[model samples]
Target: MKIVYKTDTLPHVQQVSELFRSSGIKRPYDDLERLQRMLEHADVTITAWDGYQLVGLARAITDFSYCCYLSDLAVQKEYQQNGIGRNLIRHLRDLLGDEVSLLLISAPSAIDYYPKLDFERTEKAFIIPRQA
Candidate 1:
Protein backbone atom coordinates (compact mmCIF):
# COMPACT_ATOMS: atom_id res chain seq x y z
CA MET A 1 0.00 0.00 0.00
CA LYS A 2 1.26 3.43 -0.92
CA ILE A 3 0.84 6.20 1.64
CA VAL A 4 0.90 9.86 0.76
CA TYR A 5 2.21 12.38 3.20
CA LYS A 6 0.83 15.93 3.38
CA THR A 7 1.87 18.85 5.47
CA ASP A 8 0.10 21.65 3.62
CA THR A 9 -3.37 20.58 4.58
CA LEU A 10 -5.20 20.00 7.83
CA PRO A 11 -7.99 17.47 8.07
CA HIS A 12 -11.42 18.25 9.53
CA VAL A 13 -12.04 17.73 13.22
CA GLN A 14 -14.32 14.78 12.63
CA GLN A 15 -11.63 13.11 10.59
CA VAL A 16 -9.06 13.71 13.31
CA SER A 17 -11.33 12.44 16.04
CA GLU A 18 -11.92 9.27 14.07
CA LEU A 19 -8.21 8.94 13.40
CA PHE A 20 -7.28 9.44 17.06
CA ARG A 21 -9.77 6.82 18.16
CA SER A 22 -8.76 4.32 15.51
CA SER A 23 -5.11 4.88 16.31
CA GLY A 24 -5.67 4.01 19.96
CA ILE A 25 -4.21 7.29 21.08
CA LYS A 26 -5.53 8.59 24.39
CA ARG A 27 -6.94 11.84 23.15
CA PRO A 28 -10.16 13.62 23.96
CA TYR A 29 -11.56 12.27 20.71
CA ASP A 30 -15.11 12.88 21.80
CA ASP A 31 -14.47 16.60 22.12
CA LEU A 32 -14.48 18.10 18.66
CA GLU A 33 -13.96 21.71 19.64
CA ARG A 34 -10.94 20.95 21.78
CA LEU A 35 -9.49 18.88 18.97
CA GLN A 36 -10.16 21.69 16.52
CA ARG A 37 -8.31 24.12 18.74
CA MET A 38 -5.45 21.70 19.01
CA LEU A 39 -5.17 21.64 15.22
CA GLU A 40 -5.51 25.40 14.98
CA HIS A 41 -2.75 26.08 17.47
CA ALA A 42 -0.20 23.46 16.58
CA ASP A 43 2.85 24.96 14.84
CA VAL A 44 3.42 21.88 12.73
CA THR A 45 1.22 19.01 11.68
CA ILE A 46 1.91 16.14 9.30
CA THR A 47 -0.65 13.68 8.13
CA ALA A 48 -0.48 10.44 6.19
CA TRP A 49 -3.23 9.44 3.84
CA ASP A 50 -3.96 6.32 1.92
CA GLY A 51 -6.19 7.09 -1.04
CA TYR A 52 -8.27 9.57 0.98
CA GLN A 53 -8.20 7.72 4.31
CA LEU A 54 -6.38 9.37 7.17
CA VAL A 55 -3.84 6.83 8.32
CA GLY A 56 -1.46 8.81 10.48
CA LEU A 57 -0.77 12.23 11.98
CA ALA A 58 1.86 14.15 13.91
CA ARG A 59 1.35 17.49 15.59
CA ALA A 60 3.75 19.76 17.41
CA ILE A 61 3.97 23.08 19.22
CA THR A 62 7.24 24.80 18.55
CA ASP A 63 9.07 28.08 18.22
CA PHE A 64 10.65 26.70 14.98
CA SER A 65 14.13 27.59 16.15
CA TYR A 66 14.73 25.76 19.36
CA CYS A 67 12.71 23.07 21.17
CA CYS A 68 9.67 21.43 19.65
CA TYR A 69 7.09 19.73 21.78
CA LEU A 70 5.77 16.89 19.66
CA SER A 71 2.28 16.71 21.02
CA ASP A 72 0.75 13.98 18.94
CA LEU A 73 1.92 11.08 16.82
CA ALA A 74 -0.72 8.60 15.87
CA VAL A 75 -1.07 5.91 13.23
CA GLN A 76 -4.19 3.86 12.65
CA LYS A 77 -3.84 0.52 14.46
CA GLU A 78 -3.92 -1.45 11.23
CA TYR A 79 -1.12 0.76 9.90
CA GLN A 80 1.13 0.90 12.97
CA GLN A 81 3.96 -1.40 11.90
CA ASN A 82 4.36 0.13 8.47
CA GLY A 83 6.84 2.89 9.29
CA ILE A 84 4.25 5.63 8.90
CA GLY A 85 4.89 6.91 12.40
CA ARG A 86 8.60 7.12 11.86
CA ASN A 87 8.16 8.91 8.58
CA LEU A 88 5.90 11.42 10.28
CA ILE A 89 8.67 12.20 12.73
CA ARG A 90 11.24 12.36 9.93
CA HIS A 91 9.10 14.81 7.99
CA LEU A 92 8.77 17.02 11.05
CA ARG A 93 12.50 16.89 11.67
CA ASP A 94 13.25 17.76 8.07
CA LEU A 95 11.04 20.80 8.32
CA LEU A 96 12.36 21.84 11.70
CA GLY A 97 16.05 21.42 10.68
CA ASP A 98 19.10 20.39 12.65
CA GLU A 99 19.06 23.12 15.28
CA VAL A 100 15.67 22.23 16.67
CA SER A 101 15.17 19.50 19.23
CA LEU A 102 12.09 17.29 19.22
CA LEU A 103 10.76 15.98 22.51
CA LEU A 104 7.59 14.25 23.56
CA ILE A 105 6.05 12.36 26.45
CA SER A 106 5.27 8.88 25.23
CA ALA A 107 1.98 7.24 25.99
CA PRO A 108 2.43 4.24 28.31
CA SER A 109 1.94 1.91 25.38
CA ALA A 110 4.58 3.69 23.34
CA ILE A 111 7.45 3.93 25.81
CA ASP A 112 9.48 1.34 23.96
CA TYR A 113 8.62 2.59 20.51
CA TYR A 114 10.17 6.06 20.53
CA PRO A 115 13.68 4.90 21.27
CA LYS A 116 13.58 2.69 18.21
CA LEU A 117 13.29 5.87 16.20
CA ASP A 118 16.44 7.33 17.76
CA PHE A 119 14.71 9.19 20.55
CA GLU A 120 16.89 9.11 23.64
CA ARG A 121 15.34 8.38 26.99
CA THR A 122 16.11 11.13 29.44
CA GLU A 123 15.58 11.63 33.16
CA LYS A 124 15.94 15.39 32.94
CA ALA A 125 12.32 16.10 32.07
CA PHE A 126 9.43 16.86 34.39
CA ILE A 127 5.79 17.75 34.08
CA ILE A 128 3.18 19.20 36.42
CA PRO A 129 0.65 16.88 34.74
CA ARG A 130 -2.44 17.73 32.79
CA GLN A 131 -5.48 17.77 35.06
CA ALA A 132 -7.82 16.82 32.32
Candidate 2:
Protein backbone atom coordinates (compact mmCIF):
# COMPACT_ATOMS: atom_id res chain seq x y z
CA MET A 1 0.00 0.00 0.00
CA LYS A 2 2.62 2.49 -1.07
CA ILE A 3 1.22 5.84 -2.12
CA VAL A 4 3.57 7.55 -4.55
CA TYR A 5 2.93 10.98 -6.05
CA LYS A 6 3.89 12.24 -9.47
CA THR A 7 3.00 14.58 -12.33
CA ASP A 8 2.52 14.33 -16.14
CA THR A 9 1.87 10.63 -16.29
CA LEU A 10 -0.39 9.40 -19.10
CA PRO A 11 -1.30 6.04 -17.64
CA HIS A 12 -3.32 7.54 -14.85
CA VAL A 13 -5.56 9.43 -17.25
CA GLN A 14 -7.82 6.48 -18.02
CA GLN A 15 -8.18 5.58 -14.37
CA VAL A 16 -9.15 9.14 -13.56
CA SER A 17 -11.63 9.22 -16.42
CA GLU A 18 -13.29 6.11 -15.07
CA LEU A 19 -13.33 7.50 -11.58
CA PHE A 20 -15.04 10.65 -12.80
CA ARG A 21 -17.81 8.65 -14.40
CA SER A 22 -18.22 6.22 -11.54
CA SER A 23 -18.32 9.07 -9.08
CA GLY A 24 -21.13 10.68 -11.16
CA ILE A 25 -19.07 13.71 -12.21
CA LYS A 26 -19.75 14.66 -15.80
CA ARG A 27 -16.77 16.51 -17.32
CA PRO A 28 -13.88 14.85 -19.19
CA TYR A 29 -16.02 12.03 -20.45
CA ASP A 30 -15.57 10.27 -23.81
CA ASP A 31 -12.53 12.25 -24.96
CA LEU A 32 -9.20 10.85 -24.00
CA GLU A 33 -7.38 12.96 -26.58
CA ARG A 34 -8.79 16.15 -25.16
CA LEU A 35 -8.16 14.92 -21.64
CA GLN A 36 -4.55 14.23 -22.48
CA ARG A 37 -4.22 17.64 -24.03
CA MET A 38 -5.65 19.26 -20.93
CA LEU A 39 -3.40 17.29 -18.59
CA GLU A 40 -0.36 18.23 -20.60
CA HIS A 41 -1.08 21.88 -20.02
CA ALA A 42 -1.96 21.71 -16.33
CA ASP A 43 0.30 23.75 -14.04
CA VAL A 44 0.75 20.88 -11.62
CA THR A 45 -0.84 17.54 -10.79
CA ILE A 46 -0.65 15.45 -7.64
CA THR A 47 -1.46 11.80 -8.10
CA ALA A 48 -1.44 9.04 -5.49
CA TRP A 49 -0.41 5.65 -6.70
CA ASP A 50 -0.76 2.38 -4.86
CA GLY A 51 2.21 0.48 -6.16
CA TYR A 52 1.76 0.86 -9.95
CA GLN A 53 -1.96 1.63 -9.74
CA LEU A 54 -3.14 5.23 -9.69
CA VAL A 55 -5.57 5.50 -6.77
CA GLY A 56 -6.10 9.21 -6.57
CA LEU A 57 -5.46 12.46 -8.44
CA ALA A 58 -5.60 16.19 -7.90
CA ARG A 59 -5.13 18.53 -10.85
CA ALA A 60 -4.69 22.27 -11.07
CA ILE A 61 -4.48 25.01 -13.66
CA THR A 62 -2.51 28.11 -12.78
CA ASP A 63 -0.58 31.11 -13.98
CA PHE A 64 2.20 30.10 -11.59
CA SER A 65 2.13 33.68 -10.32
CA TYR A 66 -1.34 34.84 -9.44
CA CYS A 67 -3.97 32.11 -9.27
CA CYS A 68 -4.53 28.40 -9.45
CA TYR A 69 -7.79 26.54 -9.92
CA LEU A 70 -7.83 22.98 -8.68
CA SER A 71 -10.36 21.60 -11.10
CA ASP A 72 -10.41 17.86 -10.54
CA LEU A 73 -9.59 16.23 -7.23
CA ALA A 74 -10.64 12.64 -6.79
CA VAL A 75 -9.63 9.59 -4.81
CA GLN A 76 -10.67 6.23 -6.15
CA LYS A 77 -13.57 4.62 -4.31
CA GLU A 78 -11.42 2.04 -2.57
CA TYR A 79 -8.89 4.60 -1.41
CA GLN A 80 -11.19 7.21 0.06
CA GLN A 81 -11.11 7.92 3.83
CA ASN A 82 -7.47 6.97 4.04
CA GLY A 83 -6.10 10.54 3.92
CA ILE A 84 -4.89 10.24 0.33
CA GLY A 85 -6.99 13.24 -0.69
CA ARG A 86 -5.65 15.26 2.22
CA ASN A 87 -2.12 14.39 1.31
CA LEU A 88 -2.72 15.46 -2.27
CA ILE A 89 -4.10 18.81 -1.16
CA ARG A 90 -1.30 19.40 1.33
CA HIS A 91 1.36 18.55 -1.21
CA LEU A 92 -0.21 20.87 -3.76
CA ARG A 93 -0.43 23.67 -1.23
CA ASP A 94 3.17 23.24 -0.25
CA LEU A 95 4.19 23.26 -3.89
CA LEU A 96 2.27 26.47 -4.45
CA GLY A 97 3.32 27.77 -1.03
CA ASP A 98 1.94 31.31 -0.56
CA GLU A 99 3.12 32.29 -4.02
CA VAL A 100 -0.23 31.75 -5.72
CA SER A 101 -3.91 31.71 -4.87
CA LEU A 102 -5.44 28.25 -5.04
CA LEU A 103 -9.15 27.92 -5.65
CA LEU A 104 -11.46 24.97 -6.05
CA ILE A 105 -15.17 24.32 -6.34
CA SER A 106 -16.35 21.54 -4.09
CA ALA A 107 -19.61 19.67 -4.29
CA PRO A 108 -22.17 20.70 -1.69
CA SER A 109 -21.57 17.57 0.31
CA ALA A 110 -17.84 18.06 0.18
CA ILE A 111 -17.71 21.73 1.10
CA ASP A 112 -16.26 21.19 4.55
CA TYR A 113 -13.44 19.08 3.20
CA TYR A 114 -11.44 21.91 1.64
CA PRO A 115 -11.57 24.26 4.61
CA LYS A 116 -9.45 21.79 6.52
CA LEU A 117 -6.95 22.14 3.70
CA ASP A 118 -7.00 25.94 4.25
CA PHE A 119 -9.28 26.83 1.35
CA GLU A 120 -11.61 29.69 2.07
CA ARG A 121 -14.90 30.21 0.30
CA THR A 122 -14.89 33.28 -1.89
CA GLU A 123 -17.85 35.19 -3.25
CA LYS A 124 -17.38 33.82 -6.72
CA ALA A 125 -19.76 32.06 -9.08
CA PHE A 126 -19.13 29.41 -11.67
CA ILE A 127 -21.28 28.87 -14.74
CA ILE A 128 -21.81 25.63 -16.56
CA PRO A 129 -23.91 24.73 -19.57
CA ARG A 130 -26.66 22.13 -19.34
CA GLN A 131 -25.66 20.74 -22.75
CA ALA A 132 -28.87 18.89 -23.21
Per-candidate TM equals: 0.98, 0.82
Could you tally the backbone clashes for each prediction? Answer: 0, 0
Q: List the residue pairs that clash in candidate 2.
A: none
Q: Give me the displacement of residue 44 in model 1, in angstroms.
A: 0.4
Which pairs of residues collide in model 1? none
Candidate RMSDs in Å, in order, are: 0.6, 2.4
Clashes of 2: 0
The weakest ten consecutive residues by lDDT in model 2 span 20-29
Error of 1 at 57 (Å): 0.2
